[model samples]
Target: MAADEGLTGSSRVTVFAMFGVAFGYATHHLDARRVGDVAVVGPLTPGVEWGLLWQMARNCGRATAGEAELARWVLTQATRAFVCGSGRIAQFPEQGWKLEPGGKRVRFDSTYANRDQLWTGNLTVEGLAPDQVAQRPTIYTV
Candidate 1:
């Protein structure tokens, strides 16, 4: 009976070890920023506006399952808004502003406690080239 019990215990240990390994492997490929307690990215274009950018970054921090992906998407959207000049009153009169890619300047900040949540940051869009735009935004997740 003792021998049988030992075999069972060994088997359980092996199973647990395997599970740990598998979990580690899966998490390895995930984005560090997403999995981390805190993350920040971007100089952004057009100009990073602290108020809106901070709100968006804080939201990203609070994200869960797909936090990294969501953050990347939000950055991309903000960039588009900058270039297209959608968020600000200043660019409204310039028809070229619409073609300019609206809001290129933005930043992201993410924070995780038990769950994910966005933290505020200082984002200000001031002197970026109006023609500059990001071809692609980076993404990562855990």
Candidate 2:
């Protein structure tokens, strides 16, 4: 996952999409600033590892109780709330996210942590394969 604002790492976009704007609100609910140009790449089916997602969510619950609480609240409010305050218009054009023709891999440095919370790093997650319908993900860190 990458954003025009900067780079962070996670494959939560698919699950996050379910919450729509509420997901953004849940993610940045404590911050006054908004996000911009967020993008993610991963398989939707055949490769989307749902088990991994569930494990991640479970791990999140165990590691960050406060965040889990906020996520729960946001999920419950997703249908009725219009969470329009958490994101801003992207400064870069959509075309800037494209890769060369027939390209199938991308490389970037991003944060990673184990589900057990024993290790973490800003290691390069190289050669990621974007799904057929997804755009190339970009990682920009300051």
Which runs of model 1 end up more than 4 angstroms from their true locations?
A: 1-65, 90-120, 124-142
Q: How much lDDT does each candidate structure score? A: 0.26, 0.24
What TM-score number comes out for model 2? Answer: 0.21
Estimate, for each residue in 7-116, the C-alpha lDDT of model 1 and write its tens digit: 00000000001101110000000243544232222233334332444344446555452544554554444333434533322222111111111223222444322223
Compared with the true structure, the alpha-carbon lDDT of candidate 1 equals 0.26
Clashes of each: 30, 0
Tens digits of per-residue lDDT, candidate 2, 1-142, equal 1222323343222212221110211121113443421222211222232223223334545455443342342233321222231222111111112111221111213321111111111111222233322322334211
Q: What are the candidates' C-alpha RMSDs?
A: 22.6, 17.3
Worst 10 residues of 1 by lDDT: 7-16
